[model samples]
Structure formats: structure tokens, C-alpha cells
Target: MVNTFQQHQHAALPRANHDERARQEFTKSLKQFVQQGLLPGLTPVYQTRAAKAFEKEHGKPPADRWDIRKAMVKDLYFQHYAATNRIAQELLWEAVIGSVERQLPELEKAIADLTASNPAPLESDPAFPVPRYVSALDIHCMPGGYASEIDGKDIAQGAIYDRGVYLYAMGYMGPDNDDMGRSVCNYVKRKMPGFQPKRILDMGCTVGHSTVPFKEQFPDAEVIGIDVGGPCVRYAHARSKALGHDVSFMQRSAEDTGFEAGSFDLVVSHILLHETSGQAMPRIFRECHRLLKPGGLMIHADLPPFDLMDPFTQFILDNETYYNNEPFWGAMRDKDQIGMARDAGFPAETIRFDTAPMAIMEFAGADTTYTEDAAEALAEREFTAGEYAPGGGWEVLIAQKAA
Candidate 1:
């Protein structure tokens, strides 16, 4: 997380405020929103209605799809409400991230410090685990995105995160993750002419954000989500149990999940690749390959490759991939994932990368299906890369497994 000029806008030379009135008002509003507009009172009802409507259309729920209808309301309300208050979200992040953000300067200084300190590498120590990649440097802008279990309990650490986002994710950040969840779930439910998945697995399912969607999509499939974080697994279990979603969450590194080969009909991940090291990416793809049923599918939702990004948007969004605790993002875009998919044994033609239209066929008051005029089809085709608009970035690469 450099404060340096060119890189972070400060990376140019290396350098870099807000006011109190706007700050206090923003904080007050946030507190009010949390206290009054969010959580217990509001989210439950919203998610219930959303869930009931889906259940009405789909019939019964999967084992893990328990009371998720309730969780959905809280999740959605927070996302929509926060997006409307972008300025407030920025203020809040400045406040919440201040402590972690302060340590950024140390990263550059550490490079100098490590050199000056003369860390000895013994000739005999050929196997010493020196940091191998540029990714080890920033760690996705996270304080320690790459560290292996600083504490004995990696899940606890992740749960702390789950709690934080669960409580505070105000706008797009919340929805970017959850909107993908709802979109995927709703999409899986409607069926595109004729398609079906027998079993589904979600990778990097932090607190089940992406995993929950599959329940709505293929209600009959056995859905499982795996991640390295223990807190996320434990909490995901607890939350899913409460919500009545029968899905399973497990604490396992995505790299080597010990599941049966060809056991899953679909393996899914949302926004996980950018946060992982390039070296780790292939292993994850292979794991998905090992876990999928023959002709099963693997699809992921994440930021598009650099090929699709404009310079200005690229600089802005990519800057976060660097400074915002997601240092691996740039590397992920740089890597040719098609090769990885192929290495994992999928036919080149089988790997379908499409940015499915984000919206579902309909909402209650609207028409049952959304019509796509010629222009609309083109835009929908670009749904993965075009929706970021003037403010945010784009989405690309649905990346399905071969038939």
C-alpha cells in the first residue's frame, strides 16, 4: 500500500485530508443508518420477502438454503443504502481504514530497511523461503494478505472481517460481492433454455456471500463452499444454520481441497482470483478440475483483464488492487487464465467466458422477462466489462467449464 507518487498518485516522488464538519455529519448519519436503517429491524423483512418470492417460484429450498431469505434482506438493504451514500462511504472508509492505511508508508521504508539491515541468507539454507514474487511485496494491499495463519486460527481472523463487512459494508463494496451473489442465484434459477447442474461448490466463499446464490439457482444440487479462513467457515456455518440454508462450509485451503474427483457439477468462485498469488491461481483451477463432475462447469465473477480496461479506469481500479489490500490483482490480470484452465484439462472451446447480463428476468412489479433490443444485446454482451460506468470498474469472465 504505497503512498508513493505515480503508483498511489503519491508514488511519483513518494508522498500525502478531510474536514471535521463533514466528517462528524457523515459519522452521525452512519451511526443513524446502522442503528435505525440497518440490521435487525429492517434487513430481515426485506430478505424474507425476496426469499419468499423466489421460493414461491422455485418450490422447495436446498438443505443449506435455510433462512437465507432473512440474511438476504440485511445484505441487500446495506448494499443499496450505502451506494446511495458514496460520499459517506468514502468518509467512513477513511475513518475505518485510517489505522491500517497508516502502515502503508512503512512498506517502501521496509524495502530500504531490509536492505540496510543485512538479513543474512546462509549458503547452506538453499530451501529458505525467501519471498518469491512481487506479490509478496504489497499482499493485495491487505496488511498481511499472504501470511499463512498469523495466529493458529486463520478463520478467526477471517470472521473478524466477516463481522466488519457484515456490519459496515455500506454500498457498492457490499453489493459488488452480494449483487454477484443475487445475480448468479437468480440466473441459476430461471434456466437458460435447458441447462442443469447436479452439484455445486463455491471457492473462497467468504462467509458464504457467493455460496448462498447457488442454493437459489439449483435447489436440488448439494452446495458446498470452501475457504482457508476458519472464522469464515465457522461463521458461515452458524449463519447458514440459522438462516436455514442447508449448504456446507468447510475450512480448507482452496489450493488442495481433499474432495472426491469429478464429484461436483459446478464449481464457482466470485472475486477470489485477484486476491490470490499468480502461482496459487493454477493450483486453485486444478483443484476445481479435480472436484468437478465430468462435463461439470466452473464459473467465476471478477474484474476483467487489462485487455478490456481503459487507461484512466485501469489506473484508478487497478490502484486499489495494489493499495487496497488486494496486491495480487494486477498479477492475476497479467496471467493468461485460459492456459491455466487448459492445463487443468478443459478443452479450449469448453471454457466459455461471458459477462452474463446482471439483471434477472424480472422483479415483482416489472415484466417477466427483460427484452434486449439490438443495442441492449451488445450492452448485455459487455455486461462484464461495461457496467462500471464513470465511477466504478467493470466485470468480465464468467469462465465456464467445458461440456
Candidate 2:
């Protein structure tokens, strides 16, 4: 099938001119080709040649992903596959950066105006110290990390991310790139039918792509999205306003958000844990527990543990740690998250891992690309390492405090 995917336009998103649009489209197509056409070859290449070669060089065949990695890295096919994947990622960000930079002044003004008119709170602290994990390197090779601001009020990083994610995901995340949050919300609604939260907190909500869905799901709830990146939260506020959601956005770290104890009925994060360090992960769980009220829910939607997948799949997913700027990508999966939740004060019986079925089918008629057949196929497809979100659903770590 010709990839008919296209990102739906929004006011806060950056506009791309003809040439820029072509470049962005090319990057997206290249990524699709990498995932659909090229990604599968690694398995055959590894099984047939790479593994045999390793056996010849050493005594035994590869025993684990580490051993498999040692074998595959030397093969020409793996080299080409890895290089093309990295190039696609680098191009994906570059394609969006120019559009954002050119429209910086206009984008900033528009965001400022949108945020000013929105009744919800938008808070930022210039004195807040950005964690070294974020500042260490430009994550995902995006030139400036999420926190970078121009004149202490930049929105370029957020705009770039907003546009870039569509290309990066090949439009699999729906028009707004909010599939993860939407999936989790659907899970909550389906699993606990009567659980309507009064206050919702989204931790590490960069640009609020995943945050706005909660407010949409629970209109009566007070939804708030917090992030350490000032630009991210600023853009999130404007984006939420532009999307017609009254959600608060604040510059705050997930490790120790200064919210009062038991202030929120629901505290969640989407793909945020993998980005944080080993030390930060446990603390974030504790913070989530602290922020949540008695009988409240805490959910983190992220990649499943390394132990769940085969060695080869783990090897494929580990490529993010080496190629992409995701420092904790591989390591985070190794951490015992259920145990961490227990340590964070959640009872052992209350914590478990669950699959939140992808809400893609709900978007069937929302966009041309999201046809019923296509959405169903995406939702039912098997999980492949290195693809965007899992085919079946988002893996969510869920816990509820004792009433």
C-alpha cells in the first residue's frame, strides 16, 4: 500500500513551504522504507551469515543480545541498515528545524497570544535548573534540546518537535501524535468504568501531545502537564489552547514536582521514563505516588521490559541507545519497574503491567490515512522492535494507592 499518511495541520504547528515540505515528506518516506522494506532483512542477514561468521570466529553461536550485537555489527548488511536508520533520524529533525527557525518570530508571537488568551495556568521558572540528562546532549540529534530558548522565550524546539514527530512516526500517531495518551485513557475508561478523576497530572509532558487527550477524555477534570523544558511547556500551553483544551502547563521536573501531597487523582507519563536516568526513574515513581491522592491512579506508558522480548528483538531496540541520543533507552528497560513502584509506596498487589490497546481505530475517519482497514491493521499487527509504538497497544505500568 502507498503510504497515504499525512499529519493534520494545526495553528501551533509550523508551516512548511514547498521545498521544505518536499524535504520533510522525503524524510518521512525514507523512514517508512527503512522500517517496512529494510528492517526485516536484518533477521535473515543475522541468522544466515552474521551468526555463522561469529561461530567461525569464536567457538559458540551468539548466546544473548550482547553476543548477537557483537556478531551483527561486523556484517555489511547490519552496517548499511544501522547507517540508513541514523541518517533518516538526522534528516527527520533537520527537515523540521529550518521551518521552525524561519518562522521563529511568527511562531513565538502566535504561541504567546494563544497562551495569553487561554484561561488555564501557564507557569515557568527561569531559575529552574535543567537536569544534566537533558542538557548533556541534544536528544534525538535535534540541534537544540527541548529546554533551549531564544531570548529566554523560545518556542522553536517545541515547534520542531511538533512537526518532526509526525515525520518520525510516519503519521502512525494520528493527526496530533497523541496515540499513547489516548490509548492509556481508553484503558483507564474501559478497565475502571466509574473512575472519573477530579485532577489529572501529566509528568514530563513535552509539548503536551499526550497531555491534551486526558482533558478531552475527562472534560470535568482539571488537567495539568508538567515538564522541565520551558519551551516545551510554553508550546504545550499554546498548543492546548489552539486545540481548544483548557489544560495547565508548567515547567517542572517529574523527579520532585513541588505539588502538594495527594493533590491529584491521576498522575501519568507517556514515554517519559526511558528518557530519564537510573537515579531519576525511582524518584519519579515516588513523586507520582506522592502527587496522587488515596485510591488515585498512577500510570506510565512506555516500552516494555527487555526480558519480555527475544534476544534479537532486544538487540534491535538497543540500537536507540547507540545511534539515537536516547541515553537511557536500553538501560531503563533493565530496571525492575514493578519493584520500583512498590518502593514508591504502591502496594505490590496494586501494581501491574498491562496493554492499552491502541486507540488508532478511533481515528479511522478523522484523517484520510487512518482508514478503518488501515487502522485495524496497525492495531492488530505484531510487535516489531525498532518500529514506532507497539503494533498491538501501548505497554502501561499501572498502580493505584490504597484508599
Candidate 3:
């Protein structure tokens, strides 16, 4: 077995420095305050205010979550929470970028050596068109988003994302920020014990954190990760190589990957759907269908759908759509994913949706118990209705091609 790249221990990485550590701590504390102090206290008050307003205006309680969200926007508490959250997010990235900028030359030299030690194949196309969904805005308030370069050979965006994501997630993604990939892989193993895929593909595999877990889970599979960002794939290749994994990292769009039809036995994505625009989703789903072999599985792990959660919870989650620069979040969440899969040519009966326990939560001593029978039972059960459980698990959509 190859040695896993323990991100926290990697000396060449940005987080190893004192400045980055302090920035991360500050970001973590800000996030905790927003999540623990502001959100919990403000939600009920906002709901009550919205409820009374709705009754006074329409002679009844708010019709749905959308109405509540609309009303909450006018609430002072909600506005304060939203503004504070945005400031915290922006400040987090500022600190990360500042730290990287301070030692760009040294960090550049360091990554060159780290990536050179065990080089994996990296393919990038200068002629490749950058999608509007990616290029339009600075998603997550990052200065240049994921596809920008400071200079001709800059990897600053990649480095910033790699180091800052853990802090952004407040360590919920574990020390490596790879729980999304690990959780999905674990679900596949328990649900399909006999299914051994020979080839695997991860779409939108930024920095390849999500890509490496597949290699760890199915060591013999030929793994390939593709993204539109050149720096992301480059950093991913270097990270994979440094970690002793032999996965190929390529710069390509998920909506139209250049791979041949039926080339992969399994295709997966982690938190990629919401990042894409509504117009791009159908094409991406079709691409996944076109890429998978007969009977091959395709799974997408992401945030829970809007309908599955209460109005308040939905309102809270929708904050990303407005403040975090993820404009497509609401549109994607409102989508019927299974319906989209069917439109992409998969049979209706083959599509499945279920929530899986997060790998990091499980590893961190949260309830890790999940058997095939238990998964099946959860699949049969309806979506739980109440306050959304934070750090509980992830929602997954699984589809299989016809044999």
C-alpha cells in the first residue's frame, strides 16, 4: 500500500506556516460564531416575524419556504446574519491569499519540488474554453475563482483552495478535507459488495482531494480526474503523485469530457452539481451517461435537496446562493435530479437517492454504523422532516446503466 498524503503534516503546504495557521484559526472561530451563536438564535425569531407578517398580509401563515425566505430577507436579524457571514467568508479568503502572496516565490519553488518527486501524467489545453459558469463570477468570494493565474506559471489559486478549504469547512471535512470522496466510496462498497470497477472517473475534481480516495478504495482501478481549471488539475496531479497514487489528472470540462463513449465503469462527483449553471447540468448528466459502461454506476454526493429540509433550514442553506457567490445553488437544489438522470437516458427504476454517514464524522467517533440492510431501510424511508442535522451526513444520488 502506498503512503497516504497527510495534508496537515505536509511541510511544503501553506497551512504548515505560522501565518496560515493563525488565519485558519481566525476563520474557524468566525465560522463557529456564525453557526453556533448567530444562526441558532436568529432563526426562530426570524421565523416568528415572517409568520406574523405573512398572516397580516395574506390572512394565513407563509405558503412555503420561499415565502419565508422572502420575508426573512426583510428581517433585521436575518440581514445581520447574512452580512456577517459574507464578511467572515471574504475575510477568510483574504487571509489565505495574503499568506500565499507573502511567500509566493518560496512556495512556488517548494511545490515544484513536491510535485516533481513523483510526477503523474498531467494534460492541459491552452485552447480549452473556460465555461461561463466558472468564469462569470468569483465563486465563494475567492478573488479569481478556481481558474485564474497570477502570472504565466502561477499556482496560487490552487494552493489557496487546497489550504483554505479545511478552514472554510471548519475541520468537518477532516484533516485532509477528503470526507466527501471517502463517504461516497464507503457507501458504494457497502451497497454493492460484488461490484468491482476497473475504471473510475471523478468530475470537477479540484485539487484531486476527492480523486485520491477512489485510488485508496479501489487500488487496482485506473482512476482519472478531470476539471476545467488548469491549475487545479496541475496541483491535483502533483498532490496525487506526491502521495504515491497513480491517477491521471486532466484539464477538461465535465459537461463535455473528451473521453470515448463507455470508457468508465464508474463515474462520480463530489459537490460539483451546485457549482454548475442550470443550462450546463443536463449536458453534464448526459456526458456521465455517455461515459459509463453498461451496468456501470454513477453517483453524485452533494448537499441535501431543498425539498427535503424545512423552510427555515432551506432558507439557511440558501444563504450560499446569495452571499457565497454560488448563484446556481438554489436552481440546482430545486432540480429533480432523478428526473434529470432519466432525461439523460437512464431508466427510472435504476435511480436511487439516500443519505450516507459522513466518513469524517464516522472517523471522528460519530455513529459509523451502516450495514447494507440499514442502507436499504433508509432508502425506503421518506426524507426526514425537521431542523436539518448539521455534520450528520451527505445526500447522494446513484444511477446505474442498463445491462
Off by over 4 Å in 1: 1-159, 166-169, 173-177, 189-193, 359-403
Residue 235 miss distance in model 3 (angstroms): 0.9
Best by TM-score: 2
Task: Give the alpha-carbon lDDT of every model.
Answer: 0.50, 0.87, 0.78
Q: List the residue pairs that clash in candidate 3.
A: none
Question: Candidate 1's residue-wise lDDT over 37-134, tens digit each?
Answer: 65344435444565565566568432222234223424556355434444343444444344223433452343233223322210111122323342
Query: What's the distance in Å from true for residue 354, model 2?
Result: 0.6
lDDT of 3 by residue, 1-403 (tens): 0111223534345644786667667877798789888989766776567678867877877767678776787788888888989988988888888888888788778767766674456787666687999989999898888888645456787878887786788756655577788777877877787989999999999888888888888889999999888778877777776566777888899999989999899999999999998889989899999999999988998877888878778877888988899999887999989999999999999998887676654443343443444334332321222322345678899899888
Per-residue CA lDDT of model 2 for 1-403, tens digit only, reads 2336466567888999999999999999999889988899999999989999999999999999999999999988899999999999999898899888898888888998998888999998767799999988998888888898756677778888999998988877867788788878878887898999999999999999889889888999999999999889989999999888879999999998999999999999999999989999999999988888999999999999999999999999999999989999999999999999999999999999998877764434333444545644543422222222334578999999989
lDDT of 3 at 236: 77
The lowest-lDDT stretch of 10 consecutive residues in candidate 1 is: 1-10
For every model shown, the clashing-pair count is 31, 0, 0
RMSD of each: 19.9, 4.5, 6.9
TM-scores of all candidate predictions against the true structure: 0.56, 0.93, 0.89
In angstroms, give how far residue 190 of model 2 lies from its true place: 0.4
Q: How far off is model 2, as Cα RMSD?
A: 4.5
